[model samples]
Target: MSTPTDAAPAQPGVRKAGEDLLTVTDLHVYYGNIAAVKGVSLSVKQGEIVTLIGSNGAGKSTTLRTISGLLRPRTGTVVFDGKSLVGIPGHKVVGHGICQSPEGRRIFPKMTVEENLELGAFLRNDKAGIAADKERVLDLFPRLKERIAQKAGTMSGGEQQMLAVGRALMGSPKLLLLDEPSMGLAPVLVDLIFDTIRTIRDQGTTVLVVEQNALAALRIGDYAYVLESGHLKQEGVARELLKDDSIVKAYLGG
Candidate 1:
């Protein structure tokens, strides 16, 4: 019965968050009559690697979609760098420096990897900057560099995953939203993906990742939120949570 104007209160553990780059409060997203996300509030500070850890259908992807403006929240506020992002469209959200590498690796299947990366920066006009970002993406994922001219659909799952993250980087995002970056990858590939995520954060981009791999996600995250059936049931410093076996075992199934 609550309306969008009744914003949820900030989570307790977020007091130490430094200069929030993305803030979502009281976000309630629905698919038809079903409430998929219920009152989830979280923040991502500038330059931090924040992870959302939970089981499948726990509103992780839904939250990212709402933030990216692919799904509008019925009641909430999404603020990015002091600018309200509630009504912004998905494409404009990219222009505001937020890009998402969505779940299922939604790359242009028929397009070559290079072409897909170019589409990631379609909203921009900076030719030099776009070119530099493309190179940077290639450097981050050498596998992608090797197959730059290949059609995206022909790549292996891990290779396609690399292309997804690489293409998101081409958008020159300040905050990158990654939905299940390690999904369906080999153990080594998962490690590689997590390592690249850390590298991305270190390279001056804030990262908000939705990951089902609790242990790996906690290992790389500065802060983490545990989502359960659409509610944020737990949150704290990632290191502390990683050390708390009870928390991980009970909520995140690590």
Candidate 2:
């Protein structure tokens, strides 16, 4: 395995053109007796929305977990910019400018919305920048601004989902990893979340979103990889994949 170093400078929510911000090669993850992910490989270029879409139990979450360093891969490499993150811990991975808004919205349930958002920036000491990011998050999800003082656990599911994404943004991540951003929500709210994802990419934060909503994910993505039973089945430009007959039949309900 390649050794990781803190050689890459943090860009703080900005991305440079033509640069590969993240790369994973032949990743295999296991949960003791289970092989959750097998031989998965993918990449996210700077300023692109690269979605990993699959059904339940397809290893989408496992792939994201490995990249975030929450789970170690049995065999693989997670390279961020020029550094290797093979054995880096989750907290250290955040310091490398990759922040993951995990599945289940994982907000600090007992803490107020404001507090949870602040915790996302705990790795930083720049008060002014953190303040700016907090305001930006509120702008993106006005509901969060309205409920800033309310406990996160009390918010509606849709509201909690918004808060989750907003909290990740508070980190000013250069490469944002969003796992299941719209898992359970009404159609209107799902549309809202997908739109916000595109807007996030437009604002220069490269994104790797893992979603079960194949059609929506493909529509907003710049590129995409389809995972099935812990293996990669296909990958291509997002728009092209949308038109693919096989992809439509298998995942898009076309």
Clashes of each: 0, 0
Q: How do the residues 151-247 of candidate 1 rate in per-residue lDDT, one tens digit apiece?
A: 9999999999999999899999999999999999999999999999989988998899999888889878888899999999888877678667877
lDDT of each: 0.89, 0.89
What is the overall TM-score of model 2 with all chains considered together?
A: 0.92
Query: For candidate 1, what is the lDDT?
Result: 0.89
* lDDT: worst 10-residue window of model 2: 1-10
> What does the lDDT come to for candidate 2?
0.89
